[model samples]
Target: MVFISLLGLFLLSLTQAAAGSQLFDQSEVFALLGDDVTLPCRVPSIRSCSSVNWNMVEEFQSITEVVKAGAVTAPGGKALRLDLLKDCSLAITHLELHDARLYSCDIGTLNSSVSLQILEVTESSNPGVDTIELHCFLNTYRGYAPCNNKGIRIKWRSGDSKPINGDRFKVVNPSECFSKLIITKKLTDHHRKWKCQVTQDDTVKATTSYTTTIKGGIEEVFAAVGESVSLSCWATSSLGGKGGGKWAVGERTLTHDMSPHNGPFHVSEDSSLVISKVSALHAGDYTCSDSTDQQRGVNKVRLHTLDVTSEREPEGDNVTLACVLTCTKECGKDITLTWSGDSRNSWQSRSMKVNNLLTNSLFLPVLSMASDEYTCFVHRDSDVMASKKWHTANPLQTPAWVVLPLVLLICITGFYLYNKRKHPKDAEHEQSSVVMTPLYEVIQDVNNEDLQHQRQHKRGTTTTTDDFYDLLQAVN
Candidate 1:
């Protein structure tokens, strides 16, 4: 049914042309929407025209002549005029929906017919999505009209003028039926809408809108210490199969074998970042993107390095301990490295001038005391990001006098053991003889006292006997 309707429309147009006094067929003119177009009627002889009349028909309704003898008389004739010398044609400016009807020029026994144009605007944009071009297109039509199509007459606009074109816009090609308009300015803003209106016969036949949007992705990420995290990204399916992915922190490129980072971060084939261990160094802004296609697919995720570390020197007068604040990537600025401990009152910090320096650390000096604890905290302003602890050993000391007895005792024991081992029998004999000499002296003294006492008693008894004898003799 659709094919028959189109065929009937074609035949009816031909039959109507035969009604004119002349039978000249003129090709249809192509024009972009909101542009100017000229419909031509010519004679083979190129003679002066007695009179050329331009007439139009609406759908199937016949209309009066829009122009006659090179004079403008149409509703849109202000911008229209006739060029009637070798050829007599009607020109219309700023064509509209009303201009889409069949236009015919009538001459003495000679007539020419042409239909206005239609165009389909192709949408195009640059790689950055910055510049966009809307160009009109049309299929081939017989220079004269037997078939009519819609696409050519379109008006492009946004909140601006209809059929917009200016310094910010460039119209490389403009026609009553077909045109190409480029937006040269940068379109970085979001959710911008453009419109295209198709018109014919002074009425709007179709209106459409072309909208451009700025896509958004993940802006930041929070990764905890010791917890695995992935910086999410999306690579266009258009990427080549051989394409590889990488990550970036500041100026440093993250690699699978970044040994300095303990090989904790690696990027997948899809450009996603997976950190097996989130360390202080690994906490920072990371860009998950493919190395090949840099612009089309790119994203950044900030990793807050939450891990902390500490180191302490051996016990001494001024024990030095350190709290390290670092990450896989250089955290931009505004970081606070703090020191705190049980010996806080007596301890001294290295220097607070270490602010914003790439090397972030807090050195704490503690007086050598038993079990002194020190804590270091990292902060961005008042928010503490990480902290660590360190303990110092007590001072070790001993006096020479206190050690003398121990040294002498050890020497005596060593000398005796050496003599006994070398001459075991001689050492045992000397030890017994020295012990028995005191016992023998005690026995000799006891015998001498008994002998003295016996002698005294004997002398006394003799004296007594002598006395008795003397006394007896005297008595006789």
Candidate 2:
């Protein structure tokens, strides 16, 4: 009887080894964190076994059954996460780091096993800068332990299939299990998604993606009151072109497919948000997000109205020019008021801020009546945000209406004087011609009378020489 029992035990050990060998290189499986994963079991006896069981091999070779008799038996919702499929494989949903372990499926005396490793991706960025770094690595044991990376490779790509390797995007391989993707922000970087892939022996094993969110890095958009403005998405001309996107302002939300008109806002065909007539109410944070509800970009729009007025200083003949800039409380801080053009001493102006309103004043002494175009600049740090031009004619300066008549009178007087001097010689010649004509006529008459007298003398009528001489004197 003892000999028979030994032989039976030997046969049982042989059968268990045969069943485990049926797994056929089912050694490891990779799954992305927070995703659903399945460990396959294809033993030939799976369908004919009297009972199917799924177990997790814990540390120190301890065995914990998760599924028994083709049903989940783990505690609480953990049991719900673990399910036995029709083929006796084990399925896990909403996978957690703690789920990474050696998983096994047992069919009576037959068994198969696989090791689970989690692929996780994370991102980091500096404040006030548009650069970000993404890290992808294999992890296990609740992210405290590194998984073996023999023959494993990691890579990064943009969107779905665009490989990322250029000046703006750089990939660094610190290890076989670790990868880093550095991105310098651009317009196209907004609303973009990057994917990390884990491959072993040239076969893709796991993938995960990270989406960039615009937080402290805001794109400032400035517009004047009553002017139309378009708030485009950070990257694309059309918002949500990849999947779908939406525009948000405070508590209000709008989708890409919405009607063209929503109050003062209009959604164009290209999916840009247009403000028909920008007003104080439109100044605030505008956010664009993808269909997955991930924030892609932010627009901090500043809407303001600028006006300038002048008055005589109470103490002197100097004029006080005050520039007023008005906006809503939603306008962010860091605004400075500066004046350009006109007097160099205008740099000595004074500025004050009350809530969202700012005033800059310059004092110009009464010297000469002059017209100057003074511009008020709204400054944020070294960058100029907006500017408004005000044409100031010193109250001491001649009015435009008064100057017009003076200019016309001066022009007429100049023309009259020029014409009078241009024809002096012609006027003298005309006067001389009028005065000398009668003298010439008298001389001609005398010559005619003399000729008549000469003819008479030649006809033999004796006319004395004294008579002829007296006639000549009378004619002269």
Candidate 3:
């Protein structure tokens, strides 16, 4: 009997894993205003899925049939099964705000896949930043419940010192396991999610949550090399050090001293990251969290930094310069780009931007030879966004050209030193050959028998990279 029970438990575990292996694995699915999204559902047993049904986990946790066997089962519902045999996924078309709810797909197994849907707040275009709303949700042992429970406390305060309580923040319970807290006020704080925490046994634990977004905030910033940049995650200074915060980029988190940020970055007591000198490495997404949120694990932070880059190429006698700004859709508007350094007066110019791609490109053709240096400037209205400097150079006078000469010099010096080690007297004229015009090309034509002897002694039949260049050209 014990053996049979152990086998049943093992099988149940396998079924649970198999059920969660499909799609986002019950992760929250965020929808926009008008998204035709799919609340994917995959059954554990494909063979039993011919009659398997998709159901909405309603207010009382009751199952309302949605679709069955690749067909809609509910009347007036736009839900459809992706496939019966290959997939048990459900597709939701014309998604609405209320559609963000819990769902499950059962295929006659001990375990089934479940997911919760939520709508992401749309970015408001309203001026004055006067109107702001905070949407808060709650969850408890009894599933999602109201936010006004005796032991329940909604922690949705922002970095702004102003307290949000009473009628300003209204808590409404439309259904079980769901509560919406609506607040109307002028907010200058960064967009953040409401933290739903429950206090029990003199200890607090976080529960179900709803995210909020801020409008008309600067989400992207571009900085020039050597320029100072201040990235504010949230104005936590007003919290009176009652809480600490953490900053992170990708998987790496920040500590007391900056390691990955080699460009001299400092964290102010106010929880703002101040980069004194920006470099190419400083460009990427930055996220921060109030240390108080570590318990809740609600990571709500945003910042985009892109360092400027310049490219130049041969164009007859002059050079064609391309100044590119790598941006993203998160970058806000009021972008004004300018150019300088080439003219006696600072030159103002416009950059062509593509919406889908956050790329901004400004091209300057046939810049006069008299120009010593060139620079590109970006601004959001009067505030300087970023600046990149480009020094004017003649064709074949670029950094690549500089590197070519240095590499050739190193090769020649090594060859000359090898010759000097053995044939001390022959090294006399080697110095003169090094000073010859077009020195790199001159080494190829040099008929120095001593150098040739050294080459023969070191390696037989020199291997040249020039032939591989032609091979690459052929492939191109």
Candidate 4:
């Protein structure tokens, strides 16, 4: 039925053109809402004539003269938005929804018609429900005939050009002219950036972006110590001139120079503050301002670092895994640390003040069979703000001091046993040799004394044979 009506309109238009003596041409122009566009008068007979006139169909089928005699004749405030062109064309700037209309350009012996349509985005958010609703649609003049949208579609996409589809995203297309996107908000979606695109035959005809504000209060940006961090400034407006502005920590303004001599803090091209190898000293309140407008306090962000360290207990057989969280601002009571691992064993974290740092320590058994992966989670109530995963030992690997002594003891015992087993025969042989040495020495002495006696007897003195017999009895 809709197609029959459209065909009827096309036939009626042809009939009207045939009845009119002037040559008639018709075209449809698509434009983005809030942008500028020109409606061309393609009639070849058109000349640089002051008699060229542009008129639009108003509500109640009234004709309103927008441009007359090469001049903008639009009423009141609309006159500022309309312009006349040399080729009898009509130019509109800063277009609004009401500007979409069926326009007629009349020149000498020729008439050109243009139907203007605009694509726009509108949003409504419910803070209580934590949801945002976006509507992308085609806008035309009220009471005017519906503009042609045969091959046009409105779609929602993420910043990375991926179509948004998940449990948190609900999409509804109520009509061919518009689409609605509903998003459930999450803490991780603080940026809340989305894009709406109008495509015709798979080609993008118009596009717009919607980003929620992170302003109105001080927010936190988490970073680990010794890691690079970038704190983004709220880009309220397009930046111009030297830079977005200055970034300051506490009262000291950060340097913007990109040279190597510049300190760790540098201002990025997008006006974010980039810190290289951020440390505890970098934890503080940071503020970004606009340079061109002299607007101060454009954004305020609190920098916090979650640092993890492990130490062996001095007096116990346990390892202390400490999560030290440093906040440039006051730490909320909801902030907490949770230790998680693959093992079923659960360790409780104890909060303590050590060396002017707030540390949460988890004491695990020295011989824990937990897996190599352990995570330290920084949580605010039920939400995980940040987490750090580290590799730890299972059976908590024995220290070198404990292992070295055991190895040394085993080596020494092996050496002693080997020597004792290998030389048993040699020890027995040595004992028998010691027993024979005394007997052999006594015999030698006895023989020597007898020889001396013999010599004396031969010289006319009798030698004592009983002394030799005494020596032999002693040897036995």
Question: Which tens-of-lDDT digit does each residue in 1-476 have in candidate 4?
Answer: 11222343354356446756363776667788689999988767655748887877654445688888788889989999888876667889998877877777776556777777777677764433777677777663222234355776778887655677557778877655677778765433455467878787888877777765533556667777777888887743464554575677777766655412243766767777788877766777777778666654467777778888888878768777888888765666556777778654656568875443567887777666356877777765334666776677543265876688789877875764466468643432332222234644664455456656766757643446887677679999
Instruction: Summarize candidate 1's per-residue lDDT along 366-426 as a digit string, tens digits.
Output: 4434345655566542234455555554433246666787899778757755775687445
- Which tens-of-lDDT digit does each residue in 1-476 have in candidate 2? 11222232334335457765333324578987778888887556455323877767555445677888877888767887877777777889998876767666667656666677788888754422667777887763222234344678888866544466456667777677777788776542443467889899999888888877654445556565556778765533343454244677665676544422344766555556787775545566666554444544444333355566778767766877787767645333455778877556533578878777788997777553244777777764334556767676545456887688778877875764465468543332332222234654564455456656666767744678888788889999
Query: In terms of lDDT, which candidate is strongest?
Result: 4
Model 4, residue 385: distance off in Å is 18
Model 4: which residue pairs collide?
A: none
* Ranking of all candidate structures by their lDDT, best first: 4, 2, 1, 3
TM-score of each prediction: 0.29, 0.42, 0.32, 0.48
Better of 1 and 4 by TM-score: 4
Alpha-carbon runs more than 4 Å astray in model 4: 1-23, 125-128, 140-148, 214-230, 233-263, 266-272, 276-476
Worst 10 residues of 4 by lDDT: 427-436
Clashes of 1: 32
Give the clashing residue pairs of candidate 3, or none. Answer: 144-177, 145-177, 244-291
Candidate 1: residue 272 Cα off by (Å): 7.0
User: Distance from true position, residue 390, model 3, in Å?
Assistant: 2.8
Q: Give candidate 2's error at residue 34 in angstroms.
A: 3.9
